[model samples]
Target: MRHFSSSATRTSRHRVIGALTAALLCAAGATVPAAAHSPATPAPPAGAPAGSGLALTPPMGFNNWNSTHCRAEFNESMVKGIADIFVEKGLKEAGYEYVNLDDCWAKTQRNADGKLEADPVRFPNGIKAVADYVHSKGLKLGIYTSAGTRTCDSVGIPGALGHEFSDAQQFADWGVDYLKYDNCNNLGVDAKERYTTMRDALAATGRPIVYSICEWGENKPWEWAAELGNLWRTTGDINDSWNSMLSIMKQNLPLAAAAGPGHWNDPDMLEVGNGGMTDTEYRTHFSMWSVMAAPLLIGADLRKATPETFDILSNHEVIAVDQDPLGKQGTVLSSDGGRWVVAKEMQDGSRAVALFNETGSAQRISTTATEAGLPEATAYSVRDLWTHTTTNTAGGLSATVPAHGTVLLRVAADKHWAAYPPAVELALDGSALVEAGRTAKLTTRVTDLGRTPATKVSAALTGPAGWQVRADSATTAAALATGRTLATRWQVTAPAGTATGTYDLTLTTRYRAPSGKQVRSSVPFQAHVVVAPPAGGGYLSDLPRLSASNGYGPVEKDTSNGESAAGDGKPLTIGGQVFTKGLGAHASSSVEYYAGGACSTVTASVGVDDETGAKGSVAFEIWSDGTKAASTGVLTNDMAAQSVSADVSGAQVVRLVVTDGGDGVDYDHADWGDLRITC
Candidate 1:
């Protein structure tokens, strides 16, 4: 029963037609109540625990969301089987509890007594029977409902809306140990008020059920859910994919302050073993969730879970970080777009650090103990959580993380070494601009921040395929003194027949720490390498290879104003004609081209791109060696193409300038099509 915002497109939905049909028919035969049964004021039974106090740590359990999604296959037998497997497979012993159900279990309508009932087909023995069975196994039972008038998957069952008290009492009477309250079909009710009502209702029931608020963070539950529920979902539903998981993680990283003991900020349920991600990616997902102190709710089918799934889910080392007594959610200390270092402070003063690589290739990620809150220059015993290996070191730690993976380590201060790792900072220059068939010199500066000399320094460059990238300086050098900067340079030559496109280059540097251990760090740099296209043939995206200038708005490339994509994916279009580049911005945008005396006559079709409507005026000017050769009077943003030519017979350079015609630039998308220079 997952729902996305209106701005988002739904990629998939839970297919539970059979369950909905049965529930709907049952509701059709049941009676409808005229009024909701709500108490005038919510008053909890004596000795009821506060919502925040219910979950002292992020709850470790399993939910049916990702696996079944309330499909017809989700029934009493399936749930009981999961509970039995949890106990039999030692998951229960490993602290995995709470067999939870999502939506679609309830009938469409309430009984004559205004009590919601379970669908006979899916739960013939009713919810209480299932709860009692779960209790017999020493486990807990969880149920789901919506905060809105109808659930997200309201094909059959209605929502709690005005029946908060009655529903909470029913759950308590049925011995439900947990409730996953959703926000679907809320009918515009204020999220805070509606969720607060449920919180009070659960409290009044005198039951110690774990309350999970699922509003998809629309109303910012973390800002106010501290007293509203034990845990709160802080993002939309998670899909079983790498991008979805990473997006959720990115959104949750900044909300760590809103989480702690009792009130955990949940980033949806886990998707490990769901067959949508690789084992390495699953490990990254699990480790990140644990590091962030998010509730560990496995959403895979335990009945068919692979051994790898069990291994990742049962890793006690990672789990301990999630359940640390300090209750501090980890913080992202540093990130380079794809690589990140997240550190959590433990109660024992040791810090748990996760070196994460979100890229598609393995990368060396490193961080200092000081940056992660560990004492600087102090010897520490490092424990690799994934491998369970221990090492003693006083310097910083580095590890090669697999693609979409993490290196989780627990650091405890030791007194063995008096030395520290050389603090190294890496910098690169001339990584943004490159031309084909030419060798570009890239300069790298590495500085040592520690008093100890960094020994055996080396650097290497990895460029695109078919490209030759080599270091001009000696790859290996003698020890570098403290506070000294080692300037390493590399020359990269693009192939003579290389294609025109942006390429990624990686620079890796290795140096020995003060502890005499080799450490490595990598930084990614982009190279916009361009090769001249055949006469009259060029891509709009490649226009940056020449020169572009803007006085007000951005220089649009091969695209309409305000859009990232070209109007029809064409390469050339101008004032309205065909051109190689579609450059546009607000006030003034211009481009310059000098083909090294390759052409004497510059011809182009200029006009506004068809996609841009009439909004502003732009005048095009052609200059040769600082002299005006031709000018296209002012042209408005209309879908019409105009032909313009300028003779640069003996000019050394040719320039094209577009300016807003005396007025502010708004919706001004100018294009140059079929531009060419002929000698």
Candidate 2:
């Protein structure tokens, strides 16, 4: 295990801001403002189109990890079925087009030509057939491999490392459109070189195979992935659990600006509709993925999806946000108390926002569009994507967000709308509005999310694109007046037909003295744009296609029959579709379910029989991957309709395996969903 050198980034808390800057930079969608970037950035590639935006626009597709079914053999029918389902099920309608095959799907070895072969058993017709099927459906096909000589599988065939050109040719021959080059063996400095090697190699193939480096966040892909590949994984494997998902999402904010039309930071795959998580949890999962602008690869049995699953996967508005041509991935603006408020700016000047409650209890998360510190005075229309309706607020003038879910709002200020710093408030002297030829005097207004004003801020801007600064100054920020926050009298002149695009002036300021740590924030120079409209598109993952039933909560409810759950009837539900069902119940209150292969649909129910004094509760849970799938208080109920029954849908690594601790209770019914397959 190669260790990372933390000493370098330790001094600076490489937390959220870094991620935000990256997302912002990439959000420019194909047009990278190299001049606007921090001077510390390396020079742009020579011979490459100068300032041309990302290679790909409106990156489309779902990843396999979301609905991946590995280890099990997949035939042409299965592979073709995926394409048909993707189109028929409306994943493509949601703007997703990539049908990525992750990890496996390869033969045990590559040929002497260095061409990787598909598992013949799984592809009786061949890899070309698979690609053709995907293409016929108007979707692109992506394949996976490791950057190391031998992959994480240890026996993975030699990939593009040493034979980059050969591998690229093989992929091109196979009509492969995308490559997810994972980092398995090589670590540290070597890992960086390997990815770069493959990147250059793929480029040599003459065909544009979108490069996706999957290194699991070893090196700062945010710092380099864009230059080398179209997309890169920011973290390691993401499972179908809430904890795993959150950890990866929280670690990615600093990389937001780096994502754009072509290059994206992958957060693994979608675990929704996978039979392990509840629909609500899946909703949260989809919201987070869309907000992050991540690749939506589904890993589930698509053949078994329900109609509601189709609806969730086919949501247009959500897909629009994800595919927004602007391609700026949303970052975590604020998070606290098991509640997080994340947001993304849309091309239409609105934002796709989400309010998530990770805890079990219902949480009220209130927020203002201003609190998240986006453009202000802008009008917003609140659309509840899941509820499929518009949210009613006191005023449509702005947005008021609620709890447990998101109010996907569209906010648009008049063309005159200007962005403000949330923590600082300034009174702009409007005389700066339009000076025929003279430079206007601009000022700053900033306030905290709480609306408290901030003052005496320092601001700086890279010289205007076409004009040299009238005042030759770089050592000090534009002057800030007392009782004022920030001010700059720019003698800037616009070039004829300059096309008036939004110019990002890196306004660096140290507004106040440090209380405990140094703080700095950047504000982009805002001006009305007269250029072409921004790009737009988004994607929905595989999660929306599965019927999830349970959101397992609390354990140890009623009377215990044994160690396992012995409910008179229904068992408990966890996540959503996953249920902890009981086998049989003689009579008992509390029942214990040990973790095992049967945690799929762990359901618990308690009942009282007049003849057989059964008066306890049934407690069962899915424990796979060493964690409980879902838990709940004793399942005791008089009404049969109210008896607990859960339907689990995902958790690829940990199959639900429950045990019966035969106590006083024998669960009348207990079962789980998405049962684990053991060879």
Candidate 3:
């Protein structure tokens, strides 16, 4: 629920180089320089209050900002109906307790006595009445206001800046359980002082109200807000898009040590059911947020929510990780290219491992129990939190994750290997690329990692419909000993006229556990069908990209960088020059095109787009195959467009990359003006 205009005054601040830049640069074989500021975990401020004993775990609830905003639908009836749905839909039982009201719930002005008043038309029965109703249902109520003189809404309702004590007293009397104090129109007051004033006011009322500091991390709230609020906003607002969520996750992932049992780092609210992203992406968002120990505030309208939304929100196993008693936030174990491995230590001696794929294509991401910080054991129980399935692993934990998807696993040391299926790791051993209608030799390797030997171990590879798969040799094994692998090669043929794209091939293995129970496990492999592009020369924008990912929003085609929505960009402009064609991308973006080893050169005039004026800086790199073919060291909006020409001859893939220029991604709108590839 953050609102800030482009012209709004804010103290100059820069974000620490987050995981996105570091990981992507590392993957590109670039040395990452040290950040200007220390990346150390910030210690809690001295004498930090222990909080109100509320929200010991990150709060789970619903906020109307993302779904309803300040619309008329967000009235008293809507509020009460949400509370009812929370009970009827089993959300309340699933540990979602708070029914929060966001901005515009109050009148434009304060009452005669300088006390804030709810809008009569919106909350006809008053906030206390709604609070009573929520409490009757065994849930708590939260209300919103800004720490400045006005709220975030355009009309600007009365804020709690100078009226903290009176407002806190009123909230206490009204049984408000949570206070989402925002930052807006602060008149340039010190952030710590403004937030700490409300903390003191809330405490003075002797009411257990959870304080959420919504300063948008402009003041490095994680460094000092721990003592002032239960949770602090770590980034700006989150729109319902893959880039937005992923960017925010990168921003929050580095501050793990600042979070604890009583204090949390809030990356805004959940956008799971908001409809902009696919279910796969939503699951990644939820899983990543849970692993980060962020608050699980449902930001979708529950009344109209689909079953899929509820399913993603009600995943109890993932929720348990968010609500773990130890309250430790997860940190990135490794991130390369678009694959990330994050692990969180649980209170029950388990480790929650999230294998996240942020690319546009499916990828095989792997990690080990030891890498996840699990103590050595004969076997480890790996439970898929999303699929609700438990399997044992000797040490390897891996999965082929779909694009923008996450596989959440809970790994724990287990001695009861006899009761569970033997851990069999399935992997593909050769190149996954095959020309359409051609046969590819796919090798399936299954390794037995359990303590006991497995009998009747068999494997089969199955592709999409109309595709044929035949084992090159015996696919069945009579017996497999511990730590032994059974490898089989299969001739997989794609049907003629098959589309050129990535397709899933399943590798299923059947074996008998020590208990003689037939156990089946299947792992997915991505088969890339490469079709040579027609010989041609054209603007890169007009060519179909193999894959594209932007750091801020979708990559713009022949337009200036715009907001999160696609097709919202303006004319492609760099400095004072406007072009009719090119790609407008944010920093930390990549667009891969199928060159088919035919394109001889890629040329572009690149610089920070004029859309961001003189505020942005970025570097443009053209990668042919896996090697850097051309690069512009760094270009700012004030600089003239720099011409780049990359020799991409014999390169199958040409990737256009924009980096944040080692400062930060803020305002890094890069333009590739008149970009063209010649064949």
TM-score of 1: 0.63
| lDDT tens readout by residue for model 3, 1-679 | 2211112222111111112110001111112111111112232333445244556788899999988878899999988899999999878877888899999899998878998888999998899999999989888899998888887676768889899999999998998888999877676778899888888888777667788998888878899988778999998878788877887898899999999877899999999888999999999999999999999999998889999999999877788788887889999999876789999998778899999998776666888999999878777777788877666667888777777889988888866545667677777873366667788787778888666777899998888888888999878998888778899988988888888777888889999887788888887767777666556788989877677888777898999667666787888887789899999898779888877678899999899877775587789999997689999898887898999999999897788998888876788888999999998
lDDT of each: 0.70, 0.48, 0.80
Instruction: Write the candidate numbers in order of decreasing lDDT.
Output: 3, 1, 2
Candidates sorted on TM-score, descending: 3, 1, 2
TM-score per model over all chains: 0.63, 0.53, 0.87
Give the runs in model 2 whose Cα sits over 4 Å from its true position. 1-58, 65-69, 187-189, 373-380, 391-407, 413-679
lDDT minimum window of 10 residues, candidate 2: 537-546
How do the residues 1-679 of candidate 2 rate in per-residue lDDT, one tens digit apiece? 1111111111111211121111121111222111111212232353332112333443455555445445454456766788888888667665666777766577777777667788777777778888988888887787877665544442354545566667767777887777878665442337667777777666665555667777767667878767777777786566565544654665566578888876787777777677666666677777777778886666665787766566666666565566667678887766654457777876656666677654333333556666554455433334555544332222221221221244344433333122222232222222112212335344433222212233344545443566433433332333333233334445455454554333333345555421222335443333322221112201101011111111111122222112222232333332222223222222211122212222244343333222112333334453333245555444443324223333433322222222222332222222322222221
lDDT score, residue 267, model 2?
76
Task: Show the lowest summed lDDT stretch of 10 residues, model 1.
Answer: 21-30
lDDT of 2: 0.48
- Candidate topping TM-score: 3
